[model samples]
Target: MQITVNAQPHEITSNTLDAALIELGFASPAVATAVNGAFVARGKRAETPLAEGDRLEVLAPMQGG
Candidate 1:
């Protein structure tokens, strides 16, 4: 399947957000995930399926306030 990450297109075979995280080399789900301009809650990643043209934004904690 094809999806856009931060506006860049990429081909991935993940059906779920968790799988997408792993495929994207994200070490863990302690961060945040946004799909297609919507904020995907932490508990919903497993059930949040991704589709073609979907946008995925993964964000992690930064050491700055």
Candidate 2:
């Protein structure tokens, strides 16, 4: 399926958010995810379904002074 990740186009075979994150090499537990402008909790990633043209935003925490 084709979806947009962080405003970039990508082709992935994952059906769930969790799978997609793993497929994209974003396996860190500290990362945050949002699908189509809605936040998806860590515990719910496994049940959150993804579709073509969907927008996935992945953000990793950054520490700064």
Candidate 3:
């Protein structure tokens, strides 16, 4: 399926958010996810379904001084 991650187009084979994260090598606790402008809880990633043209955002925590 084709989806946009952090404003970049990517072709992924996973059907769920969790699966996609793992497939994309983003299986990290510091990462945050949002689908189609809505935030998805970490626990819900496994159940969150993704579709074509969906906008998925993967954000990592930023540390500042």
For each candidate, give its TM-score against the true structure.
Answer: 0.88, 0.98, 0.94
Quick one: best TM-score, which candidate? Answer: 2
lDDT of 2: 0.98
Model 3 residue pairs with clashes:
none
lDDT of 1 by residue, 1-65 (tens): 99988788889999998888889888676788899889999888889999988999888888976
lDDT of 3 by residue, 1-65 (tens): 99999999999999999999999889787789999999999999999999999999999998998
Task: Evaluate residue 13 in candidate 2 and report its C-alpha lDDT on the 0 to 100 scale.
Answer: 100
Decreasing TM-score order of the candidates: 2, 3, 1
Model 2: ten consecutive residues of lowest lDDT: 24-33
Candidate 3: what lDDT? 0.95
Candidate 3 Cα deviation (angstroms), residue 63: 1.4
Error of 3 at 58 (Å): 0.6
Candidate number with the higher lDDT (2 or 3):
2
Q: Compose the digit string of candidate 2's lDDT tens values, residues 9-65.
A: 999999999999999999899999999999999999999999999999999999998
Residue 54 Cα positional deviation in candidate 2, in Å, after optimal superposition:
0.4
Off by over 4 Å in 2: none
Q: Runs in model 3 with CA error above 4 Å?
A: none
